[model samples]
Target: MRTTHALVQLALALMSAPQERHWGYELSKTSGVRSGAMYPRLRQMLDEGWLVDGWETSEEAGGRPARRYYRLTEDGQRELGALLRRAESDSRFGGLDLRMA
Candidate 1:
């Protein structure tokens, strides 16, 4: 699914960051995905055991309340590694000229 791919990209971005918690809006910005598409995928990832979500009460606002944060689960880390390896082996990406200037 396209959404799944986007979620994977989002997860990779989060993993690259030094911070532990990634809020919804931050993840959306980092992944180049809109909130509409990203949130449902995030919920699915949480249901699938690929991600863990929690609230940060200290950061709560008036009516909005706490923001939910997401982090990759152990299974998710392993899955990401496998997916990256597969992608690397695929000729579609392997043949690309990724050399930097």
Candidate 2:
């Protein structure tokens, strides 16, 4: 992984709920990364086999398209955790609460 700032933010966000499913938009909103940046990183994670994605349907969405959900694999937890640890050491990402809740 390249470990960009957006990737660090995404690691923090995903770590916050490792067991839960996430949508691209939700990740974008929480990580403060735009869709243009978010989706490509997500694709990278998927290609790296650190994450898996699937579709979801809910009455809550009503007429909207089925939502796509992503979840971290066991390897993802380790990868993201390592990413956060590196960020913790990097001065650029200092003082960021990069721990999982």
Candidate 3:
């Protein structure tokens, strides 16, 4: 992984609840990333086998259509660890002190 800031942000967001499914909009909001960019990166992560996705349906959602939810795979957890380590050591994030939560 390239370890860009956005990537780090997304990884942190997903890793926060690795065992729970998350909506894209919620991820975007939590990560401070816009949906326009978040969705594309999410798709890429799915294709790279870092994330598993599924549609969630709920009648309580005001009859809204199902929303796609994503969670990290085991491989993704390992990848996230590596990515966080890299980000912590990278010059670009030197002042950020990135750490797994």
Q: Which candidate has the highest lDDT of all?
A: 2
Report lDDT per candidate: 0.66, 0.88, 0.83
In order of TM-score, best first, we have: 2, 3, 1
Model 3 clash pairs are none
lDDT for model 3, please. Answer: 0.83
Better of 2 and 3 by lDDT: 2
TM per model? 0.69, 0.90, 0.88
Off by over 4 Å in 1: 1-5, 59-64, 90-101
Candidate 2 residues 1-101, lDDT tens each?
68788888888889899999998889999999898888889999999988999988677568888899999999998999888887887998875777678
lDDT of 1 by residue, 7-97 (tens): 5556556666524778888888876778887888778777878778888876465567678788878876665556555555556555432
Which regions of candidate 3 deviate over 4 angstroms? 60-62, 95-97
Better of 1 and 3 by lDDT: 3
Across residues 1-101, which tens digit of lDDT does each residue of candidate 3 receive?
Answer: 46677788898888888888989889998788888878888888898899999887686465788888898999888898788877877888776546667
